[model samples]
Target: MSSPSAAESFPAHTSAASQIFTTVLSQGPLTRSEVARRAGLSAAAVTKAVRPLIEAGYLVEDVDEDARPALGRPANLVRVDGGRALFIGVKVTGDKIIGVLTDLCCRILVARYVPLAARDPKAVLGSAAELVRELLIEADGLGVRVAGLGMAVSGDVDRAEGVVRYSPFLEWRDVPLAELAAMTTGLPVTVDNDVRALTVAEQWFGAGVGLSGFALVTVGAGIGCGLVVHGKVVAGAHGVAGEIGHVAVDPAGPRCHCGNRGCVEAIASDDAIVRQVRAATGVQVADAVEAAGLAHDGVAGAREVYARAGDAIGRGIATVANLLGPERVVISGEGLAAYDLFADHIRDAFATAAFGSAARCDVQTRPLPFDEWARGAAATAIQSFIRSDANQHLRGAALTQPA
Candidate 1:
């Protein structure tokens, strides 16, 4: 990994240039005029921004033959050069670490997974480092230098500080993950909340693209949300925005690890569902999968547990829609594997709880694999690379490989 001082600089790294580049990256291969229109910038600014990017090989232009006019010259379309740089992204879970090697366009070229022997910060970081090393080796084979590494963890992460202020699933608190990762992986690092990192990818390339406002709600070992407003990802004042999981829906419901009763996560998270299903059916289900199997087999009590979980999730979605009025809400996560059992309950509860025009918000579901979450971590690295406003403290390099 190169130090910030040694790393190549982004050409004309101004906000306008960043915005223009992002426009082409997401809604790409457009004429300069189209870039200007979409970015709400003047034509001259778009031209100016495109020049340095193209010169730096970060962007390329091609003739748009399909848009040829009767009298005028054919328009030239500008788009990102996906091969300009490579990045590594890692997602840490309780049992495993998922890693991906991606290009500047955030396309995954290689993916690797390593199961964790233990969940302690040291063990997870070691597993993460091993996974990242494998990806780095893949990038070496591709003859591309990985520019950065992004780490996504589930918790109340302080991105600006590169710290996991609290991660209940991993039982981590105030861990300086970015700095530690940089040292171990020997790459510049950016750490963030896993859900928020996923939101970055969704906003740029997935379901949230082209939308001014949207929300990503993830259901799994925990419930989490990532919110975007006014075309910007909202990282709250305390680096804790869009925490729909903690929103209490039932005062008498199960207790959450966060010390709250009836929080959405307490009812809908994977572990929560397993606990609830076991209690309802009086069968000690080993995991969410087993609990779901019981429900799928027409076990009434087990099914009710799923229904309640769905209702909690739906209420959480309604709260987001009503409060922020996002244009769309995307439901995803590993828990979507059992979507058939609870999909209806989620929709029904959302329809009932959402008020007035808020109900107009489009709700959809998308399936995401663990590797996709790792790709989201890569997106965070891409964001940091292009934007000066991204978390600065998280961007640093290590002089040596992991011990």
Candidate 2:
């Protein structure tokens, strides 16, 4: 198989240039004055940074007659050119890999899914590489070069190092995923924690847009939280900033996989709910789907089990609100399938637990399919492309190493 050459390099690699571009990318179609004000740069700096991008075709300016100044010159709206480049994003789960092809603006152009044959790092890389190849072919049909690839995995991922420190779902540890994937797919790669990847997408285009502080709580196989504080994703120094699942809610509750008792995940995760439902109903429930089915059927004790799970989830979210005091919390994840079963309980518990001002925080549900998670991965790729320090070292190192 033949590998395509690298696309044209970004015209400007300076911090000012990247910041100017990102401001337009996220809140685009704005006047130069608006871009300058939002980016905290002088009008001269915005003009200087935008010149290279406009010349490189990364940004386009259009005259807006309606917004024209009454006296002198017409103001032009600047925006990112989504068709300038293409990217591939992959979300790796326990049983499958979800991939999407996206434009520079992180819009999904095509998406594909493939079941995983194994959980080992090598197998995951192989499957992901195959998927990237398929997407590259699709990009070929569009006569566009696939500029970058982003992979999102659940667990402790070191994005700066391009390594998967540990992923319980994949049973992987210390896997240098970004370097390996770049070699296999012959494209620049960016790897991030799955929830944070989704948060990036949310920050750029979803419900969290324009908000400086927000939380995205994912309920399903695991209870996860992604936080945006002061307009930045908080990847703690150890790369484990938002582990809301491990928040111990009860000292006498069930044992969590993390070895803590009564952790939120122990009570509210999909496996946790299934385990509890099976024990409460004395019937063999294979998974969360079946447990939710039994609950929907009004089986004895099933609703109570979900009620408890909802309580735990609510408490967990309340903890987040009290600590961060975010403006909003967006609830999402695959487990939202049973949202109706526990929505009331969650809302009630949060209301009871949240402190005075924190209770005012807006809490809403948003169902995001796995394909959207893959698109979030694409958002991370777009982030890397526009930031000078994001995964640039890994890409540089990958280029020197043999495939």
What C-alpha lDDT values do all the predictions have? 0.88, 0.89
How much is the lDDT of residue 354 in candidate 2? 99
- Model 1 lDDT on a 0 to 1 scale: 0.88
Q: Per-residue CA lDDT of candidate 2, range 180-273, in tens?
A: 8877866778999999999999988899887889999999988899999998998889889788899998999999988989999999999999
Per-residue lDDT tens digits for candidate 1, residues 174-224, read: 998988887777777889999999999999999998899999999888898
> Against the true structure, what is every candidate's RMSD?
2.2, 2.0
**lDDT (C-alpha) at residue 23 in model 1:** 91
TM-score versus the correct structure, for each prediction? 0.95, 0.96
The stretch of ten residues in a row with the least summed lDDT in candidate 1 is: 394-403
Candidate 1 TM-score to native: 0.95
